[model samples]
Target: VWSREEEVRHGTYRPQSSAQLKATLGKDGKISAWRTDYVQSGDAEGETSFIYAIPATSRRHFSYQSNQRDGPWRSVNSTQIGFYNESFIDELAQAAGEDPYQFRRKHLAADSRHLKVLDTVAKRAGWGTPLPEGVGRGIAIVESFGTIVAEVIEATVREDGSPQVLKAWAVVDCGTTVNPLNAEAQIAGGMVMGLSSAIGEAITIDKGAVVQSNFNDYNILKLAGAPAVIDVHFIESGAKMGGIGEPGVPPASPALANALFAATGKRIRTLPLMTQAKA
Candidate 1:
């Protein structure tokens, strides 16, 4: 789950969602087939939330609508789906006794842009390298609005059992990056927001009235809690134009979740991870 947004957007905020993704592996531990069944319900009428996953066939996207319009925040639905699906992927890898990084590699197509981005991040972040005690690294890949992005985060367990994010690495294959500097800023900002909400951010309700009225009782990822370093790398797949702003937000939280499980051996099943401290 995630921090639920207020019902103020022209575009629906991402609804609380549930999904089950099942994959079958061959004898060599390669994914021979996979399928995802997604569900979204219990929302109000006229709610038109949507999520775009990996297309199974060649396709052309003719229209281009950015997700930054006044009331239509980008990637709300994608972020929810990424968190659930990617976290499930990590859990599957763990259950199968396979390295998460290597497991994803075996499933991706050799020539796809998604694979390239995933490979880029893993190699640059030294995916297979050893880490000091109590250190854990996690990776996640997500595709939305014509972009394929991969992220790797390294975290450590604090003395009190809380997780401390030290660094993050992101690789983007967004078909084309119009402006390198702007793209970098977009991804970095998205990651910061993603981590911010994942750590601690929520809007409670009591008797149909809002509970968190201001920042005083609410949560935010202050500077003191942010990752010290975030590195962004881009790959121009040259297939078609894609939105840079929306794609970056989906990967950060899931990568952090996987990282936490690795650092503490506890699977995360809720949001505002502080609520499940040391998880």
Candidate 2:
């Protein structure tokens, strides 16, 4: 944590700032220590748009094993933060010269319960199997509000540079679920919402006005563009009850991004994976 005096001395505390973070992982593939610092380049002005912390996404649970913020509970918050954190997890896996799935497994020693969902989802998705060129598979596990969800996404980057989600599998552990059908529906809806945000949804500002006002202009996922199959599997972990609605939203983006990376060897660092061209 940088104090205001140290921030001013280092010219880092200001309205507009950019930050860089570093992570040190132990031999066991868990983070040992993490540090980030902000570098501000603008005047100390009216409203600040710069802040940073350990991401409060579901991935936070993983880092607790390594010894690692709370904020408003929102689906989009988890979606966006999970997107970022899980993408980095894949990168770290790659950097360690390990398969992403295996890398995640190595770091799951702290919680076999989490691994339960991961193993189920991976088996359903056929992890470690090879796919045809232009097709890729990615995996993500998220625990939110005591409900854990592990999802696998299979995506194909078409010749025309479009990305298509072929299938999705979600293994959920929302303990003592009362209504299985409604939980399935909520998880499915959350997955669709997360995928839409990851694939095509965006908001723009033009001339001090909002650009996208409705569904037509907003460009959400259409029925024809939806995944061919989305399988939701529930695991009654016999723990206390948990909600199902929001946990499903967070992993969709990262799983899709990881799938794209696997398929094309092109890592995605931003949202809306289709908008960017392969390098």
Report every candidate's CA lDDT. 0.73, 0.70
Clashing pairs in 1: none
Q: What's the true lDDT of residue 16 in model 2? A: 20
State the weakest 10-residue window (summed lDDT) of model 2.
61-70
Residue 60 of candidate 1: its Cα lDDT? 17
Every model's Cα RMSD, please? 7.0, 11.2
Best by TM-score: 1
Error of 2 at 5 (Å): 47
Candidate 2 pairs with clashing backbones: none
lDDT of 1 by residue, 1-279 (tens): 333334322223334545656766566655555565655433211211122223241211122232323223457567766787688778878877899988777667778787789889999898989988778899999887778889999987677665678899999988888899999999998988888777777655476455664466667878877889889999877889887887888888889989888877887756667645363
Instruction: In model 1, state the lDDT of residue 74.
Output: 52
Which portions of model 1 miss their true places by more than 4 Å?
1-14, 21-26, 32-35, 41-73, 159-161, 275-279
Compared with the true structure, model 2 gives a TM-score of 0.77
